[model samples]
Target: MLLEDMLNHQTKIPTEWHTSIRKVGQKFDSAAEVRLALQYYSIAKRFEYDFYHNEQRHIRVYCRFKHTHGCPWMLFASPLRNLSIMSIKNFESTHTCGQHGENAGNLRASRKFIASQIQAVLKVRSDLRAVDIKNDMLSNFSIKINYSKAYESMVHATNTGSRVVIDADDRRFRRLFISYNAYIEGFIARCRPLLFLDGTFIKDRYRGILLSATGENPYQPPHRLIVISDADKGIRATIEEFFPDAFHSRCVLHLVENFKKNMKDFGHKTNVATTLDELLQSAAYKFTISE
Candidate 1:
């Protein structure tokens, strides 16, 4: 049987459970504790919160059958003594109706929960497809979600809450630029004044180039400068126009690949190409003209 099955059993509430009015005197440090208490009630009674309000000084939560109107299950909490510490003031754990259907459905499908599930998968494989996400959710949680829901969940999961600036021609995507917040920009200003510019072709249906600008920090990983169009001339002109003071350089691996392609196009023999490739690599590694 599924975990949901075990949780949905309508067993009698344990006498030692914390839902009794006696526990009302207990103090909760945060809203999470209040929610956990409600969740414990949910597990014991096989019902879930249909609505919840988290305010500055109090929290109100209501529980009912999934997709149904009010069914008399509710919980309310308020800050005790301290504004940050919440305590459950009132709760009605018993449901008027029997377990409505076996599946949790919308009860377990909060936006935050959906976003968390999407983010967990993306942390391991960023390239996972929408259909794959739908299938994964169904197989793992027994929840079937549509493509739009899955896509929206991914967007919500990845959004950094920063204003993203995109430049396009007649709404046809031309360039996408992202600016760091003021704090991050200030940190980047103190880093080494070097910019690494690189471009790779996007392998999507409407293929285009992805141009990236990155800068190195003193004791941390490189910081992204911007994302722009892949047109080489446009990229150079933009860089020169906006960031003229920074020294720019191409990625060595990309440059070597271009060199190898040119050599192969010239019909150079395998031994000649190998020798030239080795020499080019050595020259690239040299730090100064004398070396």
Candidate 2:
């Protein structure tokens, strides 16, 4: 009857749609029925204005649909809008940084907890790494992470490890690194006038350099690991870039060790060490060293 009424109307649907209108939502229905049903729904739901032009207006429609679904697992609606808008770099620039910043924090904490859970698995079956870190691979971890209430506090609000390691090389990681740099540099700035500089050659098959600086208590010792970087122009640049006011000094023991490695003569080592000590102790050397 509904089909007869639809056919009799002057608003002619294609003849190909001879099937009943009740079955219109099914995919096996005729293409004309599908098309006519879509048209009917578009007009009745006031989606006609949205149908032609890439359905940009359906973004709001999707949001409403998501709200109606009331299932958090159904993140398809949220991701659909995001994936569509992803091509427009300008649309992403505003919110992407903030979203990734929050995600970075969440990832950091998650990765740490993940590692702990994985360690427990490793104790039982150390070969789990060969398998991917999917839910199956990490079933033990997920159980602890998801089910146990006591383990919840271990999850920090801002977990970076999960975000970066799982999604390494992601654009969001790049943005997150920027925010991390800002945070660290701000922290380093607060403890001015004391800088501890040390560099070491990387070991293993490949050799590189690692250098770091931290606030030193003239009385006791520094509390935080202020900075760590390669002993190269990069580390120098970071120092010149971030901690402009702090005093610079090498770890005396490491310097002496390096001197011993390079120089054979003990007398020459003593003279070199003395000269370095004199230069560093002098007021003229303050704020003049590169790092």
Task: Show how many residue pairs clash in every candidate, following the order shown.
Answer: 0, 12
Q: Indicate the residue-level lDDT of 61 in model 1.
A: 65
Best by TM-score: 1
What is the per-residue lDDT of model 1 for residues 1-291, given as tens digits with 9 covering 90 to 100?
354455444343343332432345567778776665554445343455655656755777675552475467666788776478877788665555555444543355544456766787799898988688777766655555765556556655776333345565764667665544443465455655455667779998978877665655563446445333333677678787887654445556666767777898999987788788888888989999988
Off by over 4 Å in 1: 1-29, 65-67, 97-101, 105-250, 289-291
The lDDT of each candidate is 0.60, 0.33
Provide the RMSD of all predictions against the true structure, rounded to 1 decimal. Answer: 9.9, 18.1
TM-score of each model, paired residue for residue: 0.47, 0.28
lDDT of 1: 0.60
**Cα misplacement distance, residue 169 of candidate 2 (Å):** 6.8
Q: Among these predicted structures, which one has the highest lDDT? A: 1
The sequence of per-residue lDDT tens digits that candidate 2 reaches over residues 58-147 is 211111222344312110111123232211111110111111111122212233434543454455664543233344322422221222
